[model samples]
Target: MTLVLKPLAEQVMVITGASSGIGLVAAKLAAARGAKVVLVARNDASLTEAVEAIRAAGGDAISAVADVGDIAAVRAAAAKAVGHYGRIDTWVNDAGSAIYAKLVDTPLDEHQRLFQTNYFGVVHGALTAIPYLRDTGGAIITVGSIASDLPSPILSAYAASKHAVKGFVDALRMELTADAVPIAITLIKPAGIDTPIAQHAANHVDGEALIPAPVYDPALVAEAILDAAEHVRRDITVGGAGRLQVLLGTHFPALLDRLAGVMIPAMSDKTRPKTESTTLFEPEQRGQERSGVQPGRKTSVYTAAERHPIALRSIALAGIAGATLLAFRRSRTRK
Candidate 1:
């Protein structure tokens, strides 16, 4: 059977973690593009506010307060969306939590709690959304991190959860393909997004928690997620830095490991005071979009790559050739 893909205006999208960060941004953008949006998050007040904002801006939106970590709650949320919108065309698994501490330093329960939201939340969202999507061809976009591809020092638990998400997404994609299901399953891996995540993360370190430098705006990630809803792609890494890290980690694991060891320690600011704020146990206040901490880069190479893949490939090849020639010249001079 030939698969039919619906346009954004004709689809109903349910976004988890819709109260803040990338999920919230994606929800707003998707609504602006004419999609009926079902906003899901644990925070009822923030979810209501987000829905009202969408409505005020002349968009169709409904709120379902549910913790993605709870399978039954997520299932109910899905039912509510279907009950309200009649059907769901796109499901975005964007709910996530993090911890900033060494593996040994992290409490076992805290680590488990991180998994509940980050990894299992995606599981719950996918499991709940898949049946509906299987009946009517739709999309499942899971928001992962660049950490899925490479490990960060302080975010060990969060990194592990993302890795698990990648594994689940890959396996599910294969299953759907084998079964001849027309669902479009995509994983969006973002790196150092300028979102409220850093401020919201549970910090165990001595200094302030901050997303690493060269952060990309959450809007970039939201745009990518919305694009994936219309297009069929297996996975997309958002920032150029993230793509480079994946490539290097894959090809030069040892070198990347050494670099990470040096870079992670240097990035921490000792002067900044630390605070413990875990969205793991309870819902935090919202209304803020960006973290307001990091001054993100003006342009994203990943966005350019997405727009011009061929041109980006050509540029990469040329750069590799130039570096090889330069190295050869240096070797000759040494001889």
Candidate 2:
């Protein structure tokens, strides 16, 4: 079935993990664009602050405090959205957590908790949103990671959970399509984004956790989410660097295996103290986008090209033709 998504201005969006990071950024952006937003997260204070801030900025938004891992809570959050807005046009599953440790060193509980949030949380969000979305012909956007395809040595459990997420989303999309459900299912595979996830991670690493080099701004991901909400996309990797890593992992698994030693050390920052904070089990801090570890790029050319492929290709071909003509003129002049 062809899914026709409504314009952002005419939609009611429910975003999980909306207290901070990419989720929070997307909530604000959606509201700013005239979507009535329902922000869901475990942090009550952060949700309140985010909702108040959005309202203060002349946007319509409300907060629903619920852990995405809990299906009942997620359902209640969805009900709250429908109660407030009368219908749900888009549901974003952006709630996730991470653990920084080797698979062996990672505790079973922590690994389970990571899956609960990162994997099952997405499952919960999709299942909860599907019924309401069916009535409105809406979209379900899940924030996956490049790690969904590429495994990280130190972040084994997080990678595993994302892998599960990718599988679930793929199968669900196909099943829904076969069933003739009109809801759009999109997976957003982002690269290392500068968000508080590192600070909020359950770190078993020796030093402070970092998202590694080539991190991107959370706004880039937020843009991708909103784009999927308005337009149908199968999946989008936010950063070119991340897309490259996924390609490498796909085509040259042995090369990545060989480079593991080099990649392992890059995941931590010894200069800073090991993080004593963690959001794996509970909420720590909220209402911030960037983690301040690095200044991420303001834009991603890869993502821009992905979102507007034909337009970008037109520009690229025009530039190539112009460069060729210039080179021809230069050769003639020299002759």
Candidate 3:
């Protein structure tokens, strides 16, 4: 069955993790485009600030203070959105947390807590949004990571949770399709976007935690999520470099395994001392998009190409033809 989603102007969007990072960015963007936004997060102050900011910008927004990991809380958030806006046309599962530690070094309880926020939070958000989305053929966009495709050295638990997220999202998509559900499900696999997540992650290492190099602006991810809201996309990767890394990991697992020695240490910011700034068990009050670690790239050619595959193919075909013509002329001249 074909799924038709309403435009952002006419939709009511419920976004988890909307107090900061990509979720907040998306909520602001959606509100600007005339969608009524319901921002959900554990930090009431941040959520209220975000909602007010949107309102001050002449956009419609409301705050829902709830943890995405709790199914009942998630359900209540959904009900609140429906109660306020009359319907939920889109739901974005963007709440996530990470740990900067190896599997052996990280505590088992830490791993479970990370899963509660990352994996099961997605589970709760998706299940809670399904019935609402089914009503009017809306979209559910989950913010996963490139870690869903490639495993990281120090972030083993975070990677595992992302892997689980991808698995569950894929299976749920298939099941929904088989049952002829009109809800569009999209998995957004972002590379290291310049978000506060790295700084907020539970640090098991001695050094300050950091997202790997080739970090992208969180706006790119927000764009992808908003695009998936109006359009049906199975999955999207934000950065070209991260996409290349995933490809390398897929094709040369042994090579990535061998590179772990260098990769493990590089994932940390050695220049700074480690601080106890973690939101693994509880929420932090800080709300910002970029982590200010490094400047993030403003655009991604690969992501644009992925969004417009036909145009990408046309460019490829033209390049091939031009190369073939040049070769023919060179051969003729040589003869």
Candidate 4:
């Protein structure tokens, strides 16, 4: 069998959501680690800024503005990446959107929107990259929220989207392997990082705000994402909070689910509103709409992000759910 190890220096990585948050930071780190980068995002301004920063730091990079939710745009960006780098070594589906509303209160349109961005967006990336990855023997990495494993009433749609991503990515991984393709896929699940996601959250029910615990910097999650992609791990869960959730979910699912079901509601009842409509992704990325709710000030991690919150419940749910998974694995190992 011919061996094709990734060329760390000459390799190219296509990162969606590169205009901000994990996508932005992943591009920075990959370039630093010696990969030429192809950046994709909906915001042209942020894409320009991100590419300039990468070049300034002596990294090879190119930018393409696209809405991953829109299949055509995503396909066009993928084609551009192959043209720019001549070969793509990695693709990271890091684009995401989150809006809050009780499942019933949130309208169908909003849920559909989230589905387009979170679930179908990943599907689009997969469709675009699979053929290229097959040819290049490369990889695909998708961003999934802790919501996939944990349940939350208010962010039900957001969670559903992530849940769908996991199934999609996992199945894709199996198919690639079974077909004897030298391709790897990873799922990145990080606790809240202080990004603009929350401020941009659309209101579904009442204008309730989600006050997060202290969150970490977006750069933190970015590092973990690179780790997963480079190492070809199954899933990488970051933060003390996220670990806890995975643990409980693994071992004590019923208990963790009950507890989480109670906590989010109690928190939402006391939470305040932003008093305005905001966008999570930068304006250039989210159709040139100015992003409000300043960069998160979260600087701490309490089992989850400790410095700030993306959504009040995004981080905590991971810990609660993770625990059950952990516990179950422990029991199986002991057996």
What is the number of backbone collisions in each predicted candidate, taken in the order shown? 0, 0, 0, 51
Q: Which has the greatest TM-score?
A: 3
lDDT score of residue 9 within candidate 2: 97
Q: Write the per-residue lDDT of candidate 1 for residues 1-335, one digit (tens) a residue.
A: 65666899999999999999999999999999999999999999998999999999999999999998899999999999999989999999999888888899999998998999999999999999999988779999999998898887888789999999999999999999999999999999998898888778888887778887668888888888988888787788889887887788899988977887776664456688865666777996564568787866647866667645687788889999999999999999999
Give the alpha-carbon lDDT of every model: 0.87, 0.91, 0.90, 0.72
Query: Candidate 4 lDDT, tens digit per residue, 13-81?
Result: 899988876788778888998898999987787788878888999988999988888889998998898
In candidate 1, which residue pairs get closer than 3 Å at backbone N, Cα or C atoms, i.e. clash? none
Return the TM-score for each candidate structure.
0.92, 0.93, 0.95, 0.79
Rank list by TM-score: 3, 2, 1, 4
Which model, 2 or 3, shows the larger TM-score? 3
Total colliding residue pairs, candidate 3: 0
lDDT of 3 by residue, 140-230 (tens): 9999999999999898999999999999999999999998999999999999898888888989887788888888999999989988998
Model 2 residue pairs with clashes = none
**Candidate number that wins on lDDT, 1 or 4:** 1
Once fitted onto the true fold, the runs of candidate 1 whose alpha carbons sit more than 4 angstroms away are: 307-335
What is the lDDT ranking, best to worst? 2, 3, 1, 4
Task: For model 1, state the Cα shift of residue 115 in Å.
Answer: 0.6
